[model samples]
Target: MKAIEVRFAKEIDKSFVVFRETGKYFPCPWHYHPEYEFVLVTKSHGRRMVGDHIGYFDEGDLVLMGPNLPHVWVNDESFINGGAAYDADAIVIHFQENFLGKEFINIPEMETLKKILDLSRRGLVIQGSAREKIGKLMVKMMTMNGLQRLAALMSIFDLLSQSQELELLASPGYTPRQEDQLKGPTDRINEYIMLNFHREISLQEIAGVSNMAVTTFCNFFKNQYRCTFIEYLNQVRIGLACKLLANEQNKIVQVAYEVGFNNLGNFNRQFKKIKNMTPREYRKRLDTQLEEDSIFFNEAYIVNE
Candidate 1:
């Protein structure tokens, strides 16, 4: 058996970068990174699984993922089934908070900016009017260089720190260190399974993806993720199904088929096994979430495009 592995984000190479991708798959995965991340998904009609915060994300979704939190952006059936094309153009800033100096943010004048970075570690989504303001700054940061770039980053944080319209992504007690993420072939296998697991993926299929034999892949998968391949697959499917259950437009059978379970019976059994609740119960919880979410919605009304 091999040891477990986790990978953190490598946003550290530079202070910031603007990425533009078309049709290419983006799966940064559940790994955390060293730097704080400010990202806006301009396109992708998929659900966002940030830490424990789950929700339907259409185009123009603005989110701020804090340092070292488990999260991923999954392409839904539309992109997966239609082989649909989409783009993810984002501005990511990765820096050691006091890379400048301990005295930089410690000054009374910089208290607000310092506070924002502290809150950022737990991850947060910039919302309300600030969402638009931040989005503009994100785009603007791309055209900057030298001291200009650093200045813009500081201004962005200054604005974000004072804004009351932000949502935290992860809960308390969530610590993301870098060393835990650099796992072996397990990440490759998980990535492969996520892309293909939606279509009645077999052990042979997953094994082939791993470029290993069934006997070897099984042991490796368990050793790295601490779960059998099937267990991991079921978790992925069930996780998607949980998101789908919130949509009133989709049916249970539709969700079952959509999430990659060809058979409805198996979907139900597996959903129950992992969630300890039936599909309807899941829907019920979603409805409750919607009601609860209305409170947050009232507080922040920015994403209403």
Candidate 2:
């Protein structure tokens, strides 16, 4: 077992407000919570590995995961790429069954809320009309406490539970797990890579970060993350590239270099490999879609990356 540092949020000692205004990031690393986590992505763009499924996530991404779900919010470097301050961050609210009351569901009073949380176990992603309506409730929760907090929570479930467009993050088994086992090297490796992904990072550097031999480090990381160390690094960089591509102000080749890809051909190839289109085409398609979806995701939505 690796010495994974975990800072767990305590069970709500009677439903209180939990608002986060952080120092450019989240508090805990890749750790799970006993309390359910409802995250509103304010301004992030990167991969979200929930349980075992992997996918790219960006702005306005709201996700809900069950108790003790192994997960993380991999923030792409593009947001902090010496650009204007969009304040790259996230707001996560954690609460336990006890906070909501253990018998709330058993009493039949919280039946609907129970259904919403049940749907969330499979993981629910709010989209379209419901996102705006339900998303506002999250922002409203920030300013609430006591009975008001309970009411806000109820409204959140009522709208989200009824939404048809809510997409399931994955089919299940997200990542098969045994409780006693601990998270190994991948979390530490990814944290280091995320902090220093701008330039070059070598195998020795990563191995040293893991405090292990190169061979052992390689096997440990591959087994945990389901990708070789190098592959994960490329994915992190490419995630940044996609953010840049979507941004529209930057040039294709500059984004290539900025995201740690040295050669233009290699960047184009990798970008096409992961994103399935040339950077230019990817940017074009995203811009077109953004225009079409302009009617959605306004300031009314409350999410911190």
Candidate 3:
């Protein structure tokens, strides 16, 4: 596949397009479009690549990408190999950055909206309460038309602009490049890392995989990802460790080895560095979040009854 992709949306009278995609798997290759996109993964778990950032995404993943930012959600190997039981689904919305009109920012009411659009250049992940509210709004847009649909989209934009839970996905230094210059070595490097993250990987091995000398590979990776190869590898491991910690059955020491850390002390240091908390503390927070969610849901159920 080419590095950058051009997506041409069909002509519609509406200001933006909303699409609900369901299939055995997500088939889109690495690509980018001119339109700014709002994507919600309703079901599926996989590695989601946005520009130079690589991380796993689960159900309810929501992101906004600015014009020309490259991205794709590649489902786990089981799903792609056709042995997965459940199907994958997503709700995607596409629109130009100037969808509200070229002079829309001139209005005093749109200052926050303009800022949000600018931040979308690095891509934003909506989370917490805002994610739940905006997700329902995205679904609601699918059934409405004309003014109603436009109003729904605007509401989403407004909430996103004010959201405190938004997280930027790509690094600050990430910049879009020509298709030919973007896909070759970086794509291969990312795939190699994802596939081998659970095992011990050395600089020489990865550099050989990229067909470059170790020193040359280090420079190339730092230039592209804004971080050294070891740092990126640890980030990936820590991310997976986070997911593993969420499961009550996995102990911290077990998770450390599972994600390729040779020693628990090293794992603890790296985990704390990235998450600002120890693994045990992170798990405790997750437990608290789950308890709060359970209580909230129970109360809502009783109120509805």
Candidate 4:
């Protein structure tokens, strides 16, 4: 998608931002900003897009994204169209990579923090007990001020740096260009592809968007993105396909065409190549997992009762 550039109004005397965002639903568009973000979905169920990865998110969804990584959280259909009962809420933290100091991360004591920050370029989803602990700290940080708030943030970072339960979003091949380089030809070309990937996009048409010859555009795209134009396009389509498949009502073949694949065979081939499984297998696994979660939740509730 063509992400809007978002600029936050700096709060005077504050080196970082930590606040609760509540609404009928998250109103942010697909966007990027020049700050690393820590987000914990406290009350919501939705689809989260990070870089080129698409997946479902629910309450307790926690992710850390590096500066300039494009992302957005879209509420589920019920939250968007349902009446007043549904409310989306999250604890959000935004900080510059150098918030502590330019040389802070270079010190021996900060090695793990530095490593986690580097890994955040692909975005990291905190999982298991680490997520629970960090979520509590973030909630506590809401009421804190001054040194305490900063201390809480460092604690969260400490937890993240040591946690093995971290899942990386975005593909290994996906790279986010720096914000200063936005609107350049390659960026424009990428935006165009993201916006039109659901429909037919011709090589000549995309090259025209870049004002380059077809051959030149192809070479330029490969050099800049480290992937062929078609490969990147399929990556986007497959990402969307993963989201659509979350709704069990959507048929597999229907999803293929919906994601812009011209034929079922080609969709299957690409899906397997990117996802390492057939669509059918992917859906089945998702269903099984959901069932297990539901069972676990119910059992815990009964025991508590």
**Cα-based lDDT for every prediction:** 0.67, 0.66, 0.82, 0.83
Highest-scoring model, lDDT: 4
Give Cα distance to truth, residue 81, candidate 2, Å: 12
- List model 3 lDDT by residue over 1-305, tens digit each: 34556666666676778888889899887788888898899888888878766667899989989888888888887788878889999999999867778887668887766777777777888888889999999888888877898888878878876676666777778876554344778868977886678789999999999999999999999999999999999999998798789889999999999888999999999999999999999999999898786666434322211
**The CA-based lDDT of model 4 is what?**
0.83
lDDT of 1 by residue, 76-163 (tens): 7766565766554444555555567767768887776566666666667777788887777767776776677778777777777667
Candidate 4: where are CA atoms >4 Å away?
178-305
Ten residues in sequence with the least summed lDDT for candidate 1 = 1-10
- What ranking emerges by TM-score with the best candidate at the front? 3, 4, 1, 2
Order of candidate numbers by lDDT, starting with the best: 4, 3, 1, 2
Q: Which stretches of candidate 1 lie above 4 Å from their native place? A: 1-34, 43-58, 66-88, 107-119, 127-129, 140-155, 162-175, 219-226, 244-254, 289-305
Q: Candidate 2, TM-score vs. the true structure?
A: 0.60
lDDT of 2 by residue, 122-217 (tens): 566777777776667777777776678778777766776566565555444453244533445654675677556767899999899888999998
Q: Positional deviation of 229 in candidate 1, in angstroms?
A: 2.1
**Model 4: how far residue 98 lies from native, Å:** 1.8
Comparing 3 with 4 on TM-score, the higher-scoring candidate is: 3
Give the Cα-based TM-score of candidate 3 against the true structure: 0.74
Residues forming the 10-long window of minimal summed lDDT in candidate 3: 296-305
Tell me, what's the RMSD of every candidate? Answer: 6.7, 7.3, 7.6, 8.5
Query: Over 4 Å off in model 3, which ranges?
Result: 177-186, 200-208, 211-232, 235-251, 254-258, 262-266, 269-305
